[model samples]
Target: MRRNDHSINRAACYRSKIACLVFFAILWVAFYHAPAFAHKVTIFAWVDGDTIHTQSKFSGGKRVKGGPVAVLDSEGNELLEGKTDENGMFSFKIPQRTELKVVLKASMGHLAEWKIPAEEITGSGSESNTPETVEKASDKTSTGTGSESIKTDVEVLKPTIAGPGRKEIEEIIDASLDKKLAPIYDMLANTFDRGPGLTEIMGGIGYIIGLVGVALYFSNRRRKE
Candidate 1:
């Protein structure tokens, strides 16, 4: 009857392992807390010329009105602070030339961060927009500074055929593009707000069940042999 006893012991050991796995699976589901908190807050930011604009929203697409926005550098130093308006937007001039991190302090102790790469910013380090150059272009023909100092034929002739200066035209185009592209940026931000859905949770459960089934099958086959 030694073989019979051996099989019984093997069966008992396998049963214990299965019980532990089941216990752990239940705990896993219980402790699956990160995904829930991940969607609680989200912040998105974009650059418009010298200005950095941010949008903050809660989980259900509600705007975080009047929320405080803190701008931080890559090294975690606070650069500036501002508050969101009714539309949940906070804007500030580019403080300095480096990678920026925008943090949103929403109500109910919710916080989120958005990072803006340095390259995305138009200029760097106290560099202002080239209104001076635009002015020069406007006055170049008047000064008759001669073709020697003029870099190109376009600069020499730009003042003649323009209702607005070239810089103004560029500003207009950029504004138009930003308006058209705002919806797309918002769509992307919304995508990030989503966490795991029911399908993923169900799949995790099924995976645990299937793993236990496989273990049980191997244990049974070994015992039978």
Candidate 2:
């Protein structure tokens, strides 16, 4: 009877150990394979005659404030002067349907620009377009003066026309605001694409399971001793 009771107890201990291992394995898998939610990029830009007011935000939804927002004409003439607000919001106007350049000058001297297509600015609302190419232009003046300027040139390869009439320009502007924001959409989508993968998830789960197995093995050995 004593030997039988001892065997029963040993069997019960093994079952308990298996149950604990299974519980931890389930938890590890759940954490490892959890779905990552998609993030949105928010950009706001206002236009008035060859000028644009613009702002940008990252995935965490924090705006870049106090940045210099410059609007330039196709000829590189400075048209409107503006600065980003406390929340990174900006407002300015540009010439009607004219190809314009929007630039952001960060405090650390980092510069980014997007060329506004002529079709994007003709009408009533704001539109966004990705600058096809980005280059770092010299912000320093050639003249012996120490004055600095953010002078990057972005070219609009394809000019989109807003047709002939005023009404047509208005219609085009209204229709393209959503399309203008395409660059920002693409940026966020690409970020998610480059994030963690299924293999990484599986590896994380496997590591956690291995740790739990090690702990259980020692626990069982001690019990037997």
Candidate 3:
């Protein structure tokens, strides 16, 4: 009779673990994918040369294309504004040499921002400021008697390069990065689609059964005392 009771207890523990594991796994996936329990929308942006590229999406991987995008200066002045494309992508050139703020407003009252530093845009070949080399030239000029010549040299040092246009460069970088990141995105998408696998469910059930076994062992010891 004692041996039968032990076997029954072990079976009961395994059954309880499996039931709990399956219940929680289904509940978690349902809450994660269901619109009623979905999370807020999000946005991310990066600068490729003079153009800023952005992507916006809801928590469940739905694109937030056609969303309003606003570009602002450091002092909150509007610089430029536009809407995202069908793929939730927005690209815009830096208007002036100042700190920038890009804000995206999606549907359902979702909003996000990307704060870009002034150094990121400025000091580039396309932007302004080459004062380091200019200062060195001015120091040499100070040794002579041509202070005005130093000012002229400063202007010459601020050389601008004329290469591919902003939009073209943005497209090139985006294409390159997309190629590299495609595999990672595919892996994540597959993971979400597959949900919890058989091995994972079995592992979770095993852990729970081990915990219950330990508890039963302690309880049995206490009963004997």
What lDDT does each candidate get?
Answer: 0.77, 0.58, 0.69
Off by over 4 Å in 2: 1-53, 58-61, 123-225
Q: Please give, for residues 94-154, the per-residue lDDT of candidate 2 as tens digits.
A: 5445787877665433565667676657534324332221111112223425221211111
Off by over 4 Å in 1: 1-39, 107-109, 123-180, 207-225
In model 3, the runs with Cα more than 4 Å from the true position are: 1-38, 123-125, 133-225
lDDT of 3 at 148: 57
**How big is the RMSD of model 1?**
13.6
Candidate 1 per-residue lDDT over residues 110-186, each given as its tens digit: 89999999877743222435677657756764567643343355457685653444555556667777778778877
lDDT, candidate 2, at 166: 31
lDDT of 1 at 220: 100
- Better structure of 1 and 2 per TM-score: 1
Give every collision pair in model 2: 47-93, 48-93, 48-94, 49-93, 49-94, 49-95, 50-94, 50-95, 51-94, 128-180
Name the best candidate (by lDDT).
1
Model 3 root-mean-square deviation: 13.8
- Give one digit per residue, the lDDT tens place, for model 3 in 109-217: 6777878788766633242646675566546656777545544655676635333334343456556765676566445433433334799999999999999999999
| Model 3 error, position 36 (Å) | 13
Worst 10 residues of 2 by lDDT: 146-155
Considering lDDT, which of the candidate structures 2 and 3 is the better prediction for this target?
Answer: 3
